[model samples]
Target chain A: MTALLKIDGLRKRFGGNEAVKNVSFEVNPGECVVLAGDNGAGKSTVIKMISGVYQPTDGKVYMNGALLTGKTPEAVRTAGIETIYQDLALADNLDPGLNLYLGREAVKHVLRFPYLDRKKMREDAAKVMLSLGIVVPDPAAPVREMSGGQRQAIAIARAIHWQAGIVIMDEPTAALGVPEQREVMALIERLKKQGVGIILISHNLPDIFAAADRIIVLARGVVAGERRPAETNDEEIVRMMMGATL
Target chain B: MTDNTVNGSNTNTKPGGTSFVRSLLNAWSWLFLILILGFFEIYAQTQTGSTLLFRIYNLQAISIAASQILLLGLGLTLVIVAGHIDLSIAFSTGFAAVVMALIIRTAGADAGWVTVILAMLAGLGAAALVGAVNGWLVAILNVPSFIGTLGTYGIARGAALIVAGGATVSIRNDHTRAFGNGDILGLPVPLVVAAVLTLICHYLLKHTRFGAHTYALGANRASVERAGVNVKKHLILLFILSAFTAGIGGLIYTSRFSAGAANAGEPILLYAVAAVFIGGASLTGGQGTITGTVIGAFIIAVIQFGLVFCGLPPYWQFVAVGLVIIVAVLVDQSKDRLMGGKS
Candidate 1:
């Protein structure tokens, strides 16, 4: 089957240095593709380009073969792609329900002006959290009050709830503990069963093997190697990451 | 679940969760507000030899004063929540007052209430224009909101002065005067307007997508932008809302006074900022509430009026307001730390 999301020869140049140079990748439906690289391997740059966080010097991102022409992040979202950065960006002052529906709020007609359908939005927020099995201390509490793992779950749930066709996770479990990491892994498994394409970037080898069906290694803004988890071991992947011959 | 340090306190003390007392302690702002009202009410009871603050008689007078500053505080809350501060709100309101007065003066006679409505629209339009410039300067040109709106303060003050020709424009129109100083049933028109506006704003801030985005923009601009929301457009709209609301407040103010002058809004501008800050709105942005602002505004009005009831000089009233602002801010910080930066 053709890839649900395709990044064609993605190139990004910041001044004189090419952060991401001629990188190409594809993620088929329900497949998890890992970008394994050391620091400065252009993994972040490539991910940002695909997510429309950065304007590619030269590249084209496609969702199911349809060109996502607009450079704005909203445009990329409209094309059915969502990204979860390492920061797990959430508005700390707002409640869980408010943060979940930040830009897309439920509204009911009131005479002429459209008033917020707060009841509906709050109900939906609770529903989505339950559906994803994300347990938090209080959904009504501010996000700043949440732990790292809970925040991560909320971020992932936000992207998925948007019905995104492709989900890009940048080190989804980097700062999380073992249990939290396991929770994120279970979430990834659930997404895979739902037939959603995933592009995961990580330096954690175990996480890579656990979630990824295929791994693409990049060094110095270029693809170095590609392998299946069954076909390669951690030692080989480490050598590839260090620019040593496989 | 194993970490005691995670919540600083046990989050799951009971299946029903933390007791009502614990919940109240966490909401320190409300506690502070109730204490303020209680102290003032007691003071009034002793001074006047009767319990009278909550009575409909005193509420009319307090609300009139509260309503004037309430609009200003509400605007600042929105601007601050969206990561912007509008220093020019007071002068913008003055400019709007002048705009309304000018329309009334020109309408002469035979224009009826139609002229009053037209003037209100024109005032609003001028206010929106002022807001647009602030938005453009800050959002598009990258000028800091503090500096951008500071410049507007001078512009609006000057524009008001120029339009009024350095003299107070007496509003001859009965309808225009009624809008400011008249009554709706038993309540003052200004008080009723304030009540309606406060309800609408409370709903908007709590329930709307725009309000949610405003909170996000203040918290983390990059995050919201990446989430596919239009950051620039949202910021611009927020500033516009701030200025536009200030302008409406100005119109009502001019109507009540039966005249519009450049210096009319001068006295209340600083108090407006103080009201929002006292309401627990952060100067750095990311958090605020309309309900808090309403109460904050009433606190100011009560203090200002209470001083008079105590037979204190005007300077004492000024000192009291300043002190209350400082104390309220201190409470705001203490509350935040108590809640472990939940604010």
Candidate 2:
């Protein structure tokens, strides 16, 4: 199948420092492309380029064969790309339902003013929470009152809420414990089954082995190699990540 | 592990040790207000030796003074909640009040209530415009709100002075009399207006998306930006709201005092800030409530009146009130620390 996202010769330079050097990869639909690398291996830079958080110095990014390139995160979102950052990018003071539908809130056709159709939004939020198995005791409780795993689930739900074609998660499981990561892995499996292309940035080896169809290793701002978990082992992948071998 | 491992929540907050304490802490300011009221009541009876706790005229006095603080505090709460402050809000009121008085005075006796209405609208419009200017400066130009509003304060007050030619515009027509002295259901019209305004503000902040966004923006502007909401637009809107309410206070003040001087709004600004701070609004933003602002305003008004009734000098009022603000802030810090520890 044709790749859902294709990044060709992506390069990013900040001042004299080159963060990402002509890294190229293709993420096929219904595939989890695990981006594995050490610190400063340009994993985040590449993700940022794809999500339009940073403008690539030189490259072309194609989503479903359509050229999408730039520093506008909103444009990336409009083009069906959603990013869930490590911070979760959620309003802590706002309720879960409001955070889920923020920026694109559901408003009634009352026409008086942009009054939020809160009832409808709440109902919809409940549906999404249920689908994700996020058993929030009170959806209206502010996110600051939620636990870490629930917040992560909420962020993931928000990213997939509008059926985005590609979901880029930046260290989603970084703050999660073993069981929480397992819970999130199930959600990822569900999304992969739905044919959503996912780029997961994680240091967890077992998770990558379990979920990633193709592991793309970056070393010194270049793609060291791509390997399948069935054929390769963590020791080999760690070497590639450490720039010891490809 | 418990389900509390998901996000920032803890098991302690769910249904454990002391929910009564948590709820009380959640609405701590209300309790604080009642405490202050009770304290003053006891002081009044024992020291002043009179039944002046809820006297009709005493309540009116409290309402009149606290009402203005309540209105100003309402707007400031929004601004502060959104992680911004408008120092020019006081001047926005002064400028609008001066414009209003100028319009009414220029229109003369033949103009009547129509002129009064026109003046009020003009004042509000002018204040809103100034507020928008403050918003643009802070939101669009990326100027720090403190500096932006500082500049506006000087400019607005200067403009008001220049417009009124450093003179007080006195209201001679009976059109404004009703607004100044009229009572609704045994409450002064201004007090009633303040109460209604508080309700509207409560609805806007609690029930509307705009209110949610305001708190979100204050808590984390980056999160709001990533959500694709225009952070600048919300910040600007908040300043505009602050200006609009300040103008309301100014117009009412013009009627109550029967004069609109360029410096009319000067004294109320600091007091309003005190009220918001007293109401449990965090200085860094993202936590303020309408109920807190209302109660905080009353606490401030009561302190101001309580001192005078105790035969304290006028200057002693500030000293006593200042202590209350300090104590309120200390209370806020402790509450924050307690909440933080729980998380």
Candidate 3:
């Protein structure tokens, strides 16, 4: 089958330095692909271009053989590409339901006026959490009241419910405790089984090995190498990321 | 589950009365309570009427004042929530009203409703245009909203003065005057308009994509932009909302006075700002609701009416209002600190 999502010859520049230089990759459906790189690597820049946060200086993005480059963020979302940022992009003051349904609120007719379907939205939010095996006291609870793991889970649920074909998460397990990390790992596995393609940006070798079906390593805005997790060990992967011969 | 540090307090509290209290504190409910108590005491002593009934009786009066403030506050709330302030709403309202009067005279009596509608539209259009300029200056040119709106404050006030010719334009038409004096279901027409506007605004702010986008833009523009939202577009729309609401307020003012004056809305600004701030809206933006603003508007109105009913000097009303505003804000902050920012 054709790649579900493909990036070809992506290059980005800021002032004098090249942030992402002619990187290309493909992710098949239901594949959990990890983009592994160090602090100065161009992983984020590439992801940004793919998610329509920033247009590439030069590149073509294809979603199931359809060109998707240069589209607006809302358009990208409609095309089934969802991105979960490092901060999770949640409204702390709003309840879980409102946050989950943010910008995509459901409307009901009330005497010829459009009123929000708050009850339906709240119910959907609960169902989303329940499907993720996450429990909360109430769907109406403010996100600020939730723990880090719960917040991450809620973000994942948000993307999942939106029916994203490709979900790109930036450090989903960062700052999370071991149990929380485990919870997220399980969620990732579940997404793969559900036929959702995932791009996980991470630095942890153990996590990449544990969760990623394939790994794409980036160095100085270039794809250093690619590997299948079953065939490669941690040392070789680290060497590939660091651009060193061992 | 292994990390107990996540639930160190183990406070799986089901949002008890304390949460309600917290909401009230954030909502500036104490100020309203004090105003009610003071009114009850003074109305009891001065009048031979039932104090309870009198308080209920004054709801119309309070509603009148609250509606005005609510109209202005709704506009300002959007600006504030987007991490900006619009101090020109008072002058904008005044100018809009003055323009309405001019339109009425030009359009003739036969075109009364047309004049009213056009005037309201013109006022809103003018204010929104000005607001768009304000956003452009702030978002594109990098000027602060305080300064931009303050500058527009003078400009709007001058336009009002010019339109009114430094005098109140009194309405002689009985039909037009009826709009101000008429009651609908025991409520003043202005109050009814205000109530409807508030409900619509409450829904818009709580349930629309625009509302969510505004909150996102206010809290963190960079993150919101990264998430693919057009930050500048939302900012412009928010400012437009603020100015348009103020324009609506101008219509109400003209109807209430049966005249349009250049300086009519001068005192309304302080009260509107106070209401938004007192109702848990932060100057820092990303917080506040139309519901909170409605309550805040009524709280201010009740206090003002209470002082007058209590046989206090009119000037003392300002002092009492100022005190309540300061105290309510202090309590709001204290409550936030008490909640340890989890709120």
Candidate 4:
């Protein structure tokens, strides 16, 4: 499979501390790649760089074989890169459809007014939710009134709706209950089936073993190794994450 | 864990009808302000009867005053909703009012109509420029809004004083005076203008993408930035809108008094901010309604009217307004608790 995104020698520094150092990875189309790491292992820093939230101190990011650097978050999003932070970054006050269409709202052309195309947004939101097989009581219901699982699904739906070629989810299921977590993991698999690339950041080993096609372990701001889940067990993945002799 | 369990039990389970009623009680702070205002209105009516209400009533006077504040509050609400405050509005209003007045005076009597129009534009323009400075200082220069707007407050006030030379500039023209005293179908001209603008603001804030973005920005600016809305741009626009209203408020004041005072608008800032808070706008930003603010302004107006109607001592009026402000703030705090304490 062709690599949809390529990062080469990525380095990031915050004052004296180096968060991501000499890290490189490639994500192909339609693959769910998981990055497993212990705390403070620079998982977030790497993700931030990819989503254009932070500038890399030194490195290169290629999206669809074209170089991407110094792009704003809005620019990055326009270029089809969407990120779902662990917080879901979903506005709680806005309803699901509004959240889905936020920033990128559709407007009527009569006077170039900024009215939201509620019917279209609702229809599209319903289609996205239905495609993920996630049921929402009301598309107009605010996310603040939603469960952790449903919010996760809504965030995923938003990224996908934006036509993001690569979806980066930070700890997609860490705080979710078993059923909610399972629902999210299932959605990841669904994304892969639809031929979209996914970069999932997580600490949950079983989920890594079950959902990821390829697992990359990061430790101390470096890429420890990458292995196909079928080729390596969770114990070895854990060893790679902690740099331990296991 | 208990809270989670309680929340969990509510998962897919809305509380019973009783909780719905209970939620209304929990949301009492907003409603209570209205009730208190209503009570005062009733008391005023009872004491003075419809006779005083009819005799002393100048629907146009209230409309003109409220409309000016309405415009100012519209912008102030935007800034305040974004978890910030601007105190320079008084100065912004005075400065714009004087600048326009001077220009109109220079242009001659027929220039009075042109002056009023130009003055409004000048006021809006001045406020917007001041607002832009406020936004840049706060967003780019990283100054706290309180400090930034306060500084601009001093500058704008100084400019107003210098322009008028500490003297009242009478806008003495029948055409301009008509705005202050004229009526349309038993309504003040200023009120009609205010009503029109209020409707426009209501639509923009509630129905437009920019308005939604404003709410998102006010609720959590960082998140809104992350969501890719230009936080600085929005902040600038918010301040501009507020100052613009202040400019109009100054215009209305000048029209009513038929002269501009360098210090004429200082008292209005407190009343405007108070009315906003009393109307259910959170000072923390990200929560409020234009409708609520209009009602709040009415409430204040009613109180003032009520006191004078009852022949209450003028000193008591100050005490009453102060109490209303304190009670309104306390009510706002309690409402936050009921809204899940997020704001």
Identify the candidate with maximal lDDT. 2
TM-scores of the models, in the given order?
0.87, 0.88, 0.85, 0.86
lDDT for residue A223 in candidate 2, whole number 0-100:
93
Residue-wise C-alpha lDDT for candidate 1, range B1-343, written one tens digit per residue: 3332223322323433444544663455567656666877788787777654667866777778888898777777888877789988878788888888888888884558888888988988888888998999999999999999999989988988899898888877777766677778878888888788788778777766777788888888866776668888887888888888888888888888878777766788878888877777777788778887887788788777766766678677689779878876776666566455444
Clashing pairs in 1: B180-B256
lDDT of 4 at B99: 73
What would the TM-score be for candidate 3 when compared with the true structure? 0.85
Which digits, one per residue and each the tens of the lDDT, describe model 4 over residues A169-225?
888887878877777877888788878899999888998888898998999999999
lDDT score for residue A134 of model 4: 67
DockQ of each: 0.36, 0.43, 0.21, 0.30
- Cα lDDT for residue B98, model 2? 89
iRMS values in order, in angstroms? Answer: 5.5, 4.4, 5.2, 6.9
Arrange candidates by DockQ, highest first: which order? 2, 1, 4, 3
Candidate that scores best on DockQ: 2
Give per-model CA RMSD. Answer: 3.9, 3.5, 4.1, 4.3
Best by TM-score: 2
lDDT of 2 by residue, A156-216 (tens): 7786788899999888888877766776787788778878899999878998898899999
**TM-score (0 to 1) for chain A, all models?**
0.91, 0.93, 0.94, 0.93
Sort every candidate by lDDT, greatest first: 2, 1, 3, 4
CA displacement after TM-score superposition, residue A35 of candidate 4 (Å):
1.1
As a whole number from 0 to 100, the lDDT of residue B204 in candidate 2 is 82
Error of 3 at B242 (Å): 2.3
